[model samples]
Target: MIGVIKALYRTQLLSIKGIWYLFCSIRLVGMNLMALLYVRQKLCPRQIAISENGISINYCTLYTQSEHLAAQLAIHCDIKPQQKIAIMAGNHNILVHALFALARLGADIYLLNTELSATQLRDINNNVHFDWIIHDPEITWLPPINNLPTYHENQISVYALLTALPLTHQMKIEITHFAKITVLTSGTTGRFKLARRSGQAQNFVSPFFQLLVKLNLSHYRKIYIATPIYHGFGMATLCMSVLLGATMFLTRRFEAPKACQLIAHNKIEVVTLVPLMLDRMLTYSETRLQSLRCIISGGAPITATLVKQVLDRLGRVLFNLYGTSEAGICMIASPDDLAVYPTTIGKPLKGLCTKLVAKESAANMRNELYIKCAWSTGGHYWVATGDLADKDADGYYYLNGRVDDMIVSGGENVYPFELQQCLSMHPKVKDTAVIGVDDEEFGQRLVAFIVLASDAEQTEAIIFSWLKTMVARYQMPKKVIFVDELPMTEIGKVDRKKLRQLLS
Candidate 1:
């Protein structure tokens, strides 16, 4: 707790001037009754809030535009409180402004992924029953729906609409409650499920403070968010940027060279990305990332090889975050923790209760990880993570695999993640994914899909010879297939379903 206070002080949020601006920013969102009593002041009028595509937007302009957009939405689009609205777009200034405007209207906002297919979108819309859709010009291929109002970047310019509206001292509007936002799951396995975060500020106190102290985010003045804003990891970064008044860097689409250029030119201090994005950036020169103080990797399973590689190339700046969409962020592995055990996911965050539940009454068996935290979806009750894990003597936790992903081969239990981790340690293997396939003698056999290093040449026999010493006989893969690259999900997880399709 003392460390949290120190971090906040370092960010200047504890000072008198900072307090005033913080209060004003909250008031601008219309989240409190005290806002009505306090004197009106612009929220960080001169401070730059967001930078995207070589353009910068200050706080005053952001807030004012949000106000104007809110009024226009209410009058022209018939947007009202409790109305369900969907925003399907990438990270941009308009996206930020639209979020603020919708919050001011006290609407229920659903964040849709840009990678979602049209059929998936239709399925989601049927369940959510959205009142309106605000999307970018790139997403112009929306399915036709009767009587549905949609706003597109190419069809309607938000700034132009706001400018066309009449200017008044104040709009006749009062926000009685804060907006409710629904974030979708990664949908890696199947259909996406809706996950709602607690809107109360008190609910965020535990994890929020823990991140500030552990990541030292308060000390960073510039941050580059390389993940999608619709995801929990990226959304948290967006909110933190506002709270600390740090300059945020965003891009509609992620490109390795472009991202490297931006980070190098801007001298970005903090970077939030997935492991795949980090790997792609590493393909460029390491000097481009020398300006970074902290690099946060989440939204996917990070291998031990990647951890060691990051430490060797980037010093002690890498942090691995292990979490789920429903559970939110629960564990953080710092550089020191990774140095000790590259495979460990470190310890649980403060105010979280974590336990392992076994599938059977057998001893020395890996168990499913369950967590109970204030910020998670369920209240007070333990949320099943569906991940099989075990803890070391020193209390560091390591994931074995998913409970459903465990395969029974020759009446023996085998976890694919274990084999995949071992394969990833090989010098010739760049990346790999292991899956269970049907077998005649054994109930199921493991098949390894590997992507070799660009400069290395290896055969299945050589890989098998190397793996003989590393893994047990039952754990060995029955077949090894080399590929140029493995299919990946939007959030950077290996697409096992697609890998299984290749077997067919």
Candidate 2:
């Protein structure tokens, strides 16, 4: 009994030490990021920093072009301290710069999606109170007349407004000056949960970039961005790029072949993607990514097959960035980690704390992941991460997909992503989605929706062989339906709910 108790005590002590070490590491990364940003501000100052017109900003332009543009926009904003200003737009260089300028001016921002309908916009506006609306002329106008702004974006888009707007060095950064941004967690559907994060909460991205730099991610003089600017990943990435002195190429939406060509032609070194976008890029082998060094996948789980294909074809430059807008940036899979742990999401970001809790239900046991931030959005919303992960005995983390996405079959727990990754390995398979279907016997049965390559024709045996090799027997899908393409959400992810309805 004494031996067992002593061993348990030693184990508990080790766990505590690991957490402290992790926290210290994150503090160091944040410090490096802060120092680097200060350095760039001092030495790499430019009114309009850019790489080429192939990009909006080119090598000869100023590093602070977006900053200058924001200064001008701030004049129109008439923004005062403690006021909230909402920014909704497709990805644009000006939007990113404008946001920082807004922060500098001590105004809170509501980063919103432009895709919501006029009625939907009005509904959101009712819930999220904003003092001013600064957004794209096109999207802002899309809202219904009722949702129409008390202020207008079109007036500025016309004539020499860019010059006539506002230009003043009047931004002061104080804790009180930083207002919380209210972002809707669910995409315009169910009751909106506002993820209100302050400037201190939002500041983690700078350290994330610094950590990546330390990890030896190839720096991009010019980056091509395609995600909607209002979304967290898009908003977060654009903000972080500013500190790196990188020129940004912002697109309205994801365009597969064109995006590929842009990366090849523009020599875009760094880019962000979800799994769906990664699938599209991999399907067409036309793009030569010689200069591309980093591809950060977030917002969803990316499969091993996709990672392997990218590494095999593009010479191994894939990264996994794990975080939510509410949590700021947390864990990331470095390029080197991908080489060794083909399945893990790398290690925690320096200073970020992660733990594996026994997932408890009324009846079953599973692993629930808890990520505690060292500098997590430090107010109103500071709970541990809700996602679940299975930590190996060796301390690597394996994402078990989202808690809501898990399914039970024949008394065994099966993760949807575990099945999807298996089906995707088939040569005939182009992409795949797995969802749970009601079964009178088992409560839920696994069903797969697959997109096959246009050139290849295959039988069930071949597909099953692919699945059988990668996943365990019970995890194998009970049924498979091949489709021309999987249904996608507006934000570019597989719509599993829609798939379940169709199957039902």
**Once superposed on the true structure, which residue ranges of model 2 sit more than 4 Å away at CA?**
1-42, 45-55, 58-77, 117-126, 137-176, 188-192, 201-206, 361-364, 378-382, 407-415, 425-427, 437-446, 459-479, 497-504
Residue ranges of candidate 1 with Cα displaced over 4 Å: 20-28, 32-43, 140-154, 157-169, 360-364, 408-413, 437-444, 472-474, 495-504
The worst-scoring run of ten residues by lDDT in candidate 1 lies at 32-41
Give the TM-score comparing model 2 with the true structure, all chains together.
0.75
Clashes of 2: 18
lDDT of 2 by residue, 148-183 (tens): 232254545411333353444554333233355556
Q: lDDT of each structure?
A: 0.78, 0.61
Pairs of residues at least 3 apart in sequence or in different chains that clash in candidate 1? none
**Highest-TM-score candidate:** 1
Cα lDDT tens digits for candidate 1, 1-504: 799889878766676766785567465555621221111224345677789988998766776777788888787778888888888777788778777777777788888887777788888888878888777766765656422223334445554555565656667766535566788885444468888765666777688788899988988879998887878787778887777668889997777789999999999999999887887788666779899889998776787778888899889999988877666789999999988888778899988899999875485377999999877888698988888889989999988888888888998888888899899989888888899898999999999999998889999999999999999899999999998888765555577878988888
Report the lDDT of model 2 for residue 236.
68
